[model samples]
Target: MPDTLEPVRIASKIMKINHAGEFGAINIYRAQIMVARLFSPQLVATLEDFLSHEQKHLEIFGRILQSRGIARCKSFWLCGIGGFCLGLITALMGRAGIMTCTAAVETVVTHHLLAQLASLEAENDSEAYQAVQSILSEVLEHQQHGIEQSKDSLLFKPVSAVVSCATSAVIWLGFQL
Candidate 1:
């Protein structure tokens, strides 16, 4: 689908949003790991693994932003703070809550990234597009893992809906900022 937003503008916004998103994801997992240590010890390792992936993704976008002299997203640290709070709350709810949060946020992220890729391609912003492409596989994997893990969680439906909405809102806000 053709984007209503201009291609160049969308491409730059995509990079900023994705960078901020990775920052959010990193904090989310960090908080999840902290709580999982007590409430769901078995999940700590997986959380750590996810954390590492987010950190790498952050660097990928960060480097692009720096090289291109694009300013960081206006919402960058806000995302981190919000992410940690969301993570703490969800983690307190237990494993299913953790999975639900991941499922919801990643679902929004995947949709955004796919759309971003299309816009970036249209703009011929190869550097930004390639950077986005490189991180998409792992984002998909995270989404898949969350979907699989939360399939049986009682909290899946409601929690996912709320978190997904919140995630979408944040992404939208990033663009506005």
Candidate 2:
């Protein structure tokens, strides 16, 4: 790639990864909401609120990706299915399990966004850097929300580590994908 285009490529790649992640988040929340009826109304309300926030994040990232002309993942449907399966697995593990999973994923995403923000800052591309900063702020909010929601759960620690590791692995493979 040409030198000038390299940064744009990096930005676009980050955006693509973010877009996919946000989409997956939305799907996972959707699955949770679908299964919420089996649980309490209070739990359902919380999950619904989380889902709405994720939906907004998805919409924002989708617009950013589209405006940048980045093509969405060819396997997005498959990814959604995979996310649904993950949600189902968490659900089977119970409410605490599902909440832990959310916390874990959000923690990883927050760290990933931090790294992206650093890279964008280092690149000295103000526009892209600012965009990343904005994304990072939203990601931080999401992480905090997840933590607040899952604070009382015993599985939070283990779930956070496992999810952080899994998300990192997924992102590593994403570059090749």
Top candidate (lDDT): 1
- Writing each residue's lDDT as its tens digit, candidate 1 over 90-140 gives 999999999989989998888888888777787888998899999889989
In candidate 2, where is summed lDDT lowest over 10 consecutive residues? 1-10
| Segments of candidate 2 deviating more than 4 angstroms | 1-8, 149-152
Q: List the residue pairs that clash in candidate 2.
A: none
* RMSD in Å for all candidates: 1.5, 3.9
Candidate 2, residues 1-177: lDDT per residue as tens digits? 111223546776766677677777777777777776686345678777777776776676678778877787554564466667766667666777677778777777777777776666667756656655666665666577667867788877776677667666666555556
**What is the Å distance of residue 123 in model 1 from its true position?**
0.5
Instruction: Give candidate 1 regions above 4 Å deviation.
Output: 1-4
Model 1's TM-score against the true structure: 0.96
